[model samples]
Target: VAEWYALVAAPGAMEAREPLRDLRGALRAMLARVRGGRRDRVGLGRAEPTLRWLRSLSAFTEGEPGEGREPFELPRFWDALDQTFKVTSQEATKLSLAFSRPPLTSAEDCRKLSEDVQNAILAVATVYYWLPKGQGTTLRKMVRDATTEVVKGMIQLTETILSAPLESLSQEQLISTGGVWEACEQVSNLPRDNQAAVASALAACLGVVKDALEEMEHALVEGQDPYSDIVEDEELGFRGNRDTYWSEADRKLLSSCMGLMKASKACLKKVLAVVKAYGKADSPEQIAQLDDLADIANEISPSVDELALSMYPPMNQLAVRLNAAKLASVLKKVLEITKTSHVCPPSEEGWVQFLTGAVDHNMNKIKNFTQGQL
Candidate 1:
């Protein structure tokens, strides 16, 4: 307010003051709501549009400024940006935490927070005016990334609330609350905005796949369970022996399992490379596709972990087969998504096909081993 008033004498500076003032008012309103918010209810339909819009804005930020650029500069914008972000973060924390107690956060309180969110959106959009003409893409991306997290966090919290029965708190609700906070906490750390963050995240997924692969390799090469070292000796008598060594059955099933895991790791590696290097986040649909790829890749690691954990002595072949099938299913979903997303364009399609073949072959081998066809 002081900054704007100070510049009031300057020509054309008057126009920026009202939105800036409105932003201040919105934050204050949100602050009050956080201090004593009520319970709430909302649908999923309201949330998806924000996600889609942010993705579109993300692409808009990436483009050449062209003729859409506007004027009216603001000084010390980072200080203001940080302040609004802090308030918005607090609001998200309060709303998400509210969901933890009896009675969900109220629709009205959400609307209050949303006012702040919108103002915060306006606050960051000021980056266009903050930077001299040709605001570096970095700041613009920061705007989009920060806004995306805030929007997505709120939507996630709302979705969690909507799905949970009002009669009682559910595990999904608790888990999603933590997720919302974790995401909100990452706002300051979105290095180069959503693109870079997605790349870094996909890289993390790749690392997890590698870890799972190495774990299986140890199980294969050492002929021992990789997750534990304490060896349980085989019972010699009629009590159904608990063998310390891999049964001929174990080795065959594990060998095929390892093959499938290797294929999984390779598929992830190839997909990560494609997304990091060439995935187009240039449109809402494109960005949503990238998100789907990330989501499906994330799903792969947990399945691999489950399969690896089940590979120990007294191994349940059914469990192993089930896990492998789940992984293959997720892999297939990745292919389904890649058919349209930039992650597997025509040029990259061949490797996906090869990986698909590997997954299927290894999968069949495991089925054969599990079925006593070995």
Candidate 2:
């Protein structure tokens, strides 16, 4: 019960290295108290099995260390386990005395009581000793059997928590920084104060949208196919008309933008992972490969941004509907580093088609929202 409470109330504490020290302290105290007792207090019959168990535990604990083992040395760990074995045996004696054999009891009852007491003592001894031995084979099986019912009780509670919806998040809280706010201000024509307030709110919403999309993407990558609330949110927003003069072209730009963005993040993840595995490549070819990848990611960024602009050139009498400049600059720097010199500028046809589709989607959503406001 104490172990269970420790697990429940302070699960994080289990991760720290000091618990073994506490166990050692408890064992030492138990040993001091037990030694003060009369020599014959624990009979030979009781003492023999207890001593054998302690020896087994000590042998296992003092064995040669394995690679990447925990910091606690084998000797110290063995001493601690040996002490705990003594403590558990002492407790078992008290229990045995309290439930002493009845003189006239049936032979079966006496046998069963003895077996129960022995099993209890063994179980406690096994756990105390096995922990330092790195997932003991026999002990794990015993613990699994003992904790099965307790674990079952926790299942429903765990399920409820796991199934719960993500907590509500404001737009400002979702984004990493105020970059989205600046973009919103550039695009929206609201009065200064209104734009400031609305952009702050919208930036937060955009941040949340980005986070939700990332979660979905990650889940998809992991083969989890998480059910998402983003689709519902998207449907509730204004739908744009795709037939506008530049919609087709503008959408192509957005596609390029997305590709460059994804590639940048992907390349970086790969580079970091490679560095971790191989540890600073010394060869020129290896260094070149890493450098080339980085440059390619950078170059792609600008090309996509340019595509976005060409597709959505400012219309006469109409303010620009998008801001693609900042994104373009990021891409230019990437291209310079990759220095692949072979650039895949956004294809005109592809840009036109992409812009057409995006404009249609955005216009329909926007029209729907405007009508509702009326």
Candidate 3:
């Protein structure tokens, strides 16, 4: 009867509480039958005590292995051989302490019982440490839990860009794909006087893409077990119904962050093409147009910041977040490279070097961001 209860209490042991409760009742009846001479009828000692011993052993083994292993007991016949084959370093000391008194044989059982008690105590402590720090802080706890999902999104986006083909993309396909290119063109085509409108539309698109990327990356980064922090709030602890709601909340947050990243990447690529084209111009009016490209680059700064903010746990360092700002600075440098070429160095080779550094520095930044380091 106790062995049956042991099986039921094991992690993920019974499919439902109803099964466990039913099993418990059945076990109690079996114990009553054993005490009522049913086992003697079968010519074996009453099974109640033996069953209880096995159950005690089962409880002693939980979480100690740190890996998957079934809960079971060895026959007492093998106990001596098992002890001889592998006496642990502490076994002698443990045995000596157990045999220190008249009831010394009970020492081993007492040690196992002590271990079982310690395991149970530690389990509760682990859960308490993960829980919200204060009373009525359920919302804050939820947000902290949700942040893991957000970081997963950013990690996914980084992988996507890392694996992106370096080969040049088709201009026609880029524009028609309704991704970053299309969004960029839309921003560019707006009336010159409506700079605010252009910024708004670009910003909105960037926002969606950046958010989506963050969520997608976060999903790929993996998460700690949600039940790890679960503690018994007495009757309030069994809120299993909240699982779906919490999962849905995670999905929404991840989706929003990924979308924002996607849009930002697209718009930035389009703005880069425009900058490259404008950089080749010789007239003062054309050179002044570079300022507009710089303005667009500045607008994308928030999305970069968002991406960095979402990469956590792995890339919690400020240097990692600063890479995005460095990329933006590099883009600005590209513009300045074009602007100052005729004035300072007075040589085309010097300008070429500046352009080379712009590309090389930004590429390094991308590499660091993708690797979740700085």
The lDDT, on a scale of 0 to 1, for candidate 1 is 0.59
Alpha carbon lDDT of each predicted model:
0.59, 0.34, 0.36
Highest-lDDT candidate: 1
TM-score of each: 0.51, 0.19, 0.23
lDDT of 1 by residue, 269-312 (tens): 77778877887645556666766676677788888888888887
How large an RMSD does model 2 have?
A: 23.8
lDDT of 2 by residue, 281-368 (tens): 2343443444344334434334434433333323221111222333334434433332331221233234323433443454344334
**Per-model root-mean-square deviation over C-alphas:** 14.6, 23.8, 30.0
Off by over 4 Å in 1: 1-188, 191-193, 221-243, 372-374
Model 2 alpha-carbon drift over 4 Å, by segment: 1-240, 243-246, 279-374
lDDT of 3 at 200: 38
Clashes of each: 7, 40, 35
